[model samples]
Target: MAQQERGNRSRRSILEAAARVFDERGYDAASTNEILASTGLTRGALYHHFPSKEAIASALVAAQSEALVVPDQPVKLQAVIDLTLEFARRLQHDPVLRASVRLAVEQTSFSRPAQTPYEQSNATILDLLRQAREQGEVLPGVDLQEATSTIVGAFTGLQVMSQVYSNRQDLPDRVCALWRFLLPGLATPGMLARLRTAPLPQTAPQAAPQTAP
Candidate 1:
């Protein structure tokens, strides 16, 4: 049992270190040596857990893709808001998520394409929007497919901008502003009135200071 726990810890450490390196240097430029150096682990230890650099990138993407938790709310629109706000919060604090976003965007540079994470995210948002439409939480006549695509695109753009401008220190405000601008057009009057867009509770570890590549 102790050995298994230690193995899990070692694997997690490698992933986190790889995430930081990837987030800084991007996939093609990021070196496996840097990842191992960051983890303070020998090559053998890293290879035991992950066969190659691509494996580490794949693992980070899969890990970040699974981190979102859909809140249970009577008004599914509110749940959607919660989901976006929470993700923004995580993006500010979580290295793995930051790396995942970078990988998803720059995946064309990689030998193997990374598509599942984006597809999963889109599917999750689309599912929630569909439910909101069915529950009448969305404004009348709103096209859910378009709305879903817009929301995902807008949210991704906002985070990228925030990261560039302020290292995501302003992400909470940007996300709040995003909702304030979007909710009126997206939500029913009562749903909009009831929705809360204040900063969500953050449970992730504090982000380390980012260094330029």
Candidate 2:
């Protein structure tokens, strides 16, 4: 049991180190040597856990995907808002999430396209929209599929621009602005009036940390 615990710690250390390096240098430009240097782990140890650099990148993506927390709210549309706002706030501080976004948007020769993360996000939003429509929170004639795609695409674009311009320091504000523009088209007038576009209180529940593999 002690040996298994140590192994898990070692693997998490490697992943955190890799995530920092990838966040700073991107996947292709980031070297395995740099990751090794960051972790102070011998090549054998890293290889034992993650056969290659691509493996590390894939793990980071999967980790970020699993970290997303969608709240269970009586108002389903508000749950969607809470999810996006919390994610934007986390993006400013979480190195693993930053690396995941970079990996998803900037594909390299070694990495395949990042479809899984986007697909998962789209599916989650679609599900929320379906529930919202059923509850009459959504505006009439709002196509859930198109709304799902638009929200995901716009959020992605906003984050990319925020990264370039403000290093994501303004992501929460940007996301709030995004929802203000988008909600009118998606939510019923009464629902829209009740929704808050500003960042939720910092006391809002956050995503739980993922367990080490």
Query: Could you estimate the TM-score for every candidate?
Result: 0.86, 0.90
For model 1, residues 1-213, the per-residue Cα lDDT tens digits are: 698877887888888888878777867888999999978888999999999998887887776567667888787888888888878877877777788776766673454563656667788889999998888888988888888888888887888789889998998899889889998999988888889989887654665432211
Model 1 weakest 10-residue run by lDDT: 204-213
* Model 1 bad stretches (over 4 Å): 108-114, 201-213
Which regions of candidate 2 deviate over 4 angstroms? 108-114, 203-212
Q: Please name the candidate that would achieve the greatest TM-score relative to the true structure.
A: 2
The number of the candidate with the highest lDDT is 2
Candidate 1 lDDT for residue 163: 84
Candidate 1 structure, TM-score to reference: 0.86
Collision pairs in model 2: none
